[model samples]
Target: MHAIKIRLSQEELEQLENLAGAGYSLEQIAMYLDVPKNDFIAEFYDLDSFVNYHYKRGLLMVDAAAGLALAANAAGGNITAHQQLEKIRMAQFVEREKKRIIYGQETP
Candidate 1:
């Protein structure tokens, strides 16, 4: 089945990214866009789709912001932030190790 493509203006695309970065769900985003939820879901059925790509990019923006905040706080000697940063580092290490084990040393 062919997927329906929605043409979005640059402004709309930025709006989508901002909304996604603010942690809006797909259904909520659809409402904000004035599109039916099912249509939005159908258009963004896969990771490769532009909508989903923007969504994930938005999430990455949030991750980057949070990481920066955590690092800044840790640098300022906030004990709780330091512990949180360490936990994040450990989780990232564990994820990399799991990928290495599953995909061998060839894993990036």
Candidate 2:
């Protein structure tokens, strides 16, 4: 299958930067740039991809923010809502499994 080219232009990049600075969501920027999110959209589902893309492109704090957002969503909460649900999940899981002297669940 031929790969679909979805490149960001200088103007689009500038707009994205402006949106980010204005605290817009990734979905909003992507939508404005004509990048659709769907079941077949790999980059959209992979939060690290967005984080790394912004990080390597010199957008400070975006990567970590994206990471935290993804982690929060994975723990069953609104994505990008600034909640520490992922950390809480990890802490709870650790507390339950770590002290089980002989029944420690094997982390797969």
Candidate 3:
């Protein structure tokens, strides 16, 4: 079986970038684009990277706003924000520990 070639219009590209920025999975984006997920994956070269570029671009704006909010909350002594930040840090530490154990390294 031969692979199908899909050409996206400028509007479609914009829609794709929007959907990806909204944290839609590849499968979800494929569905929105009315294409089979496997076919979309087969046709697109470096699909994840392409989507991630758009996603990160969108996140840049959000990150800036979030940073401002975080700073404001920190300044106001918001315990909830501090706790949430600590929770995120602990989660990251746990993930790193899991990776280290999986790679046969000692977890400090």
What tens digits encode model 1's per-residue C-alpha lDDT throughout 13-55?
7788899999899999989988778878876776667777788
lDDT of 3: 0.66
lDDT of 1 at 89: 87
* Ranking 1 against 3 by TM-score, winner: 1
Each prediction's TM-score against the native? 0.77, 0.35, 0.50
RMSD values, in order shown: 2.9, 11.4, 5.8
Query: What TM value does model 2 have?
Result: 0.35
Task: Output the lDDT of residue 15, model 1.
Answer: 81
Name the runs in model 3 displaced over 4 angstroms.
Answer: 1-17, 21-23, 41-68, 103-108
Candidate 2: which pairs clash? none
- Writing each residue's lDDT as its tens digit, candidate 2 over 1-108 gives 224335566676666666665676667667777776342144434545442254234343554566666775766656544345556557767776776645765653
Question: How close to the true structure is residue 22 of candidate 3, measured as C-alpha lDDT?
Answer: 75
Off by over 4 Å in 1: 1-4, 95-107
The local distance difference test score of each candidate is: 0.83, 0.56, 0.66
Give residue 30's error in model 3 in angstroms: 0.9
Lowest lDDT 10-residue stretch of candidate 2: 51-60
lDDT tens per residue, model 3, 1-108? 344455566676677767766777768878898877776665554545444455456555565567568757866899888776667668869978888988876666
